[model samples]
Target chain A: MSKGWDPGLVLSWTVAVIVAGAFCWLLGDVFWNGLGRVNWQFLTEAPRDAGRSGGIGPIIVSTMLILLVCMAASLPLGVGAAIYLSEFTDSEVGFGRMIRRSLEVLSGVPSIVFGLFGSAFFCIYLGLGFSILAGGLTLACMVLPILIRATEEGFRSVPSEYRLGGAALGMSRTRRLLYLSFPAALPSVVVGFVLGLGRAIAETAALIFTSGYVDRMPSSLFDSGRALSIHIFDTSMNVSGGEAQAYGTAVVLVFTLLSINLAASWITDRWLYRESIGS
Target chain B: MFQFSSDTILFGVLRLCAIAAGSVLLLVFVFLVVESWPALSNVGLVRFFSDESWHPAGENGLFNLLPMLWGTLFVTAGSVLIATPLGIFSAIFCHYYAPSWMARVYRRLIELLAGIPSVVYGLWGLVVLVPLIRELQPPGPSLLAGIVILTLMILPTIALMADAAISNVPKQYLHSAAALGLSRWSTIIGVVVPAARSGLFAGVILGTGRAIGETMAILMVCGNVVQTPSSLFDPIRTLTANIALEMAYALNDHRSALFFSGLLLLLLIIVLASLAETVRVRGEVNV
Candidate 1:
């Protein structure tokens, strides 16, 4: 289907290049403006004078804490749900469809709405009172859909022949899933967790409601903490003289996300490589 | 016997997690409704939406949501208008025109774009785009800035979705169109695009939902002026921004009003999402 030069094709392709160029420009702007501020002190030292001076040490720690808690809560539950949907049930049938539809609905619910829900349920009603635990729980709900979908896809990708072979070997369904299917899906599942972690790391609104913006090291999950995204929001919008610090923080957040994404793609490529070899 | 079995226990645990996932949605709805009751009760549901003023000051209560709702709709529509054609064209180019290696790279780039956090987009908009807008029209933050930023923010989603849809179109159609002596571009526009139409519509609808529900990026650049924007340069507040800005200090009915705003956002999202779902299901049925 190699084509001669067509005006429409040229035009569409030009638009694509323009789109890609805009993306590159945006990334270039962020890195060029923000990367200069990064250093050992910036990464390790605590902020002073309402985050105008010093560094984003506590915010980094807080963000990591919330992310760690969120992953801990979401991964097991998400993997379990994915297993149940793809393995235990005929996903085209009643309960599985219901579960999938709920996920779709939940995924579409705005992050700000999740903020409101977290404020109401986790912060106020549940008496968690604006802490890392509260924020992490809110984020767990937020990431659960992505996790389930990815893990379910991973499980589903384990060929039917593998399942048939397991059954033929007189293995029960649960045993086979635990011993064979799940391990095969581990790479994809890890990829999903990294993606979900990227999102959790980036979240500001949902954390705003559940995680109170205390700009110091939190000793426990009950203490309020600041996340990097929220730090960017506060510094850029509310705090004075924080514009530079905000850009610096944005650079950190963006790079952190980039690493996660790179890890995911690497894992995915590795899985593909292994699959190709196995086939 | 089954109760004591490890397999039964494992299945039960998995099923419970699945149910927990679904139940979380239900709980969110219930919490939102309960919290929003005061505003709904005080202002009355009809007047709440219909009244033009949004003042929550002094003795007399006002919880009008029309202006912000209008702002949300306006910004979303503007973003959709800008992004839709560019996204579709990019998707088409990637699918039909670009070399396979280029398409693969484009796909990865789109994924990377999607992975960038919304707040980072906000930071970019605040530092970069807002300044550019300020030069065009003084005082930077306005509906146009919001629109432009949102358009950039959502481009990846729409492009990726359109790409997926176009890729999913069957190869037989292309073969047949080629047999009829249609050129590559003509075959795409005449046959392949038509086949992928409903899927692309679903993507467009989904993108619209993202643009509307978006908070951090738009909030950073939109100037947060609480009024119906009369022009692209006029700064305006969206429903999400209003709640985020005011929810901290809001008290009594004002707090309830914020929840009411959340309820409105939720309803809008539900409508957009279900509509997207319907379009997707319809596309599947057609296939």
Candidate 2:
């Protein structure tokens, strides 16, 4: 350690403290006002009077349903594309490069643009109407890039020696990929899924037009439903005297995201520990 | 023969998925262009660039988007300006000054910041940030409020990216600096930062992209006024916020004009993405 006070050290510490203080302030503000309103009834009952005097039961259901549809659609496509990129092709070359570039561009495209695309293409052109299906599918498009890149990185991190070893054992390519590569990359795959889930659950702009924001418990995938994020947006922005419920809903949303993030980190940490032990 | 055929089938399925994924970008572009075609033709390209304010309805409806475009750029620039230095300094602190355990915890904190929903940020802004700002000035939701919220939202991105960039600097350089009796702070500024310059630049570009694309938080705090902001306290609206605010009730030409704005935002995003990608690739080559 340096003997006395260093000016650079003071400056850097001050900057870090300021940044950390801002984060704490934001988190503290939300939790302090919001946590008191979140309880058992809040988790189980539907809202009334334009979300001013009731709980968020149906909103939770809708959020999960949208998340479900989004994951169901995105996971297979993302894993398949990742497999092709990392295992079946040279990424520096023609088709692979094109796919990579498309994903990079898609990842950066604004969420509202995805909203416009979803409304124009899915709702109107495909005749899906304003439904959970439209909203979930739009989120799927938004999340595909994250999933594909993460899973591709996972597959790439698997040692080439493992594949060679499987071949030496007379295992077929299909069996080797299914048994060897997939298991090895399972941790990263889960991380990607969780990351995508967090993103889909938090989206508001992309879902509002596509999902039609009904605030009703959806009977089927075709029903227009209000997601939790949209509920927060509406209750806070549009509805009058809806601040308390908005705080509660924001708490639920933030709590869900925190749990998801913690779970992802836990999984990755365990995987890394296990790998280090084995080596 | 059976094994070979099975492998071929697997390849075909995976290839199909890849192709489908690749085509989505093209599909988004084509769909936006097609949907906005009516506005592009009816309003004339020149009108979009004109200085008249956005009034897309009524008998004297003006389709000019210059104000909203300028608002988007202004807010993004403001946030980037504030966030870049704070993020870089915090990254430097975490990488070099903090203990390993503290660094790990700090990183988790940043990830948590990144994970919080944007709508929650908007809600917080509406209730807390706007009211606080309102105490300072009359109207709470102004360009300043939007800039402050965006700075908080994008800070984690730049910090994480800069941390990664700083970590990628070779250890040998540090060892040599120490051997030469250079102070840690001086060595960092003289050797480490310049070496990580390209990656830091990429981080700023990516952060700028995120700030530009942010919709809900900006919409809530920016007052949603369709005029050029003369000062930080003046109300303004961004292109992303404009689309979200007006999309529900918009009709005919107005609706198409919103999509045109979306198209413009998409083009801007594409330009930023390619720029960041080029910087990343060049950085790797240099390394």
Q: What is the C-alpha RMSD of each candidate to the true structure, in Å?
A: 1.8, 1.4
TM-score of chain B of each: 0.95, 0.97
Predictions in order: lDDT = 0.87, 0.90
For model 2, the stretches where C-alpha displacement exceeds 4 angstroms are A1-5, B58-60
Model 1 C-alpha lDDT versus the unseen true structure:
0.87
lDDT of 1 by residue, A1-279 (tens): 355668777788789888888889889988898899999999999998898989998889899899988999999999999989988778767999888988887887889899999989989998999899999999999999999988999898888888899989978777788788988888878878988898899888888878978999999999999999999999989998888899899899999888999898898888856974784
lDDT of 1 by residue, B83-185 (tens): 9998899898887778999988988888898888888889889888889988998888999999988898888889888898888889888888888998877
Relative to the true structure, candidate 2 reaches a TM of 0.98
Interface RMSD in angstroms for candidate 1: 1.8
Docking level for model 1: medium
True contacts kept of 2: 0.82
lDDT tens per residue, model 2, B137-243: 97889999999999999999999989999999999989999998878888889989999999899989989999999999999999988888999989999999999
* Backbone clashes, each candidate: 0, 0
Clashing pairs in 2: none
Which regions in candidate 1 have their CA more than 4 angstroms from the true location? A1-5, A276-279, B1-4
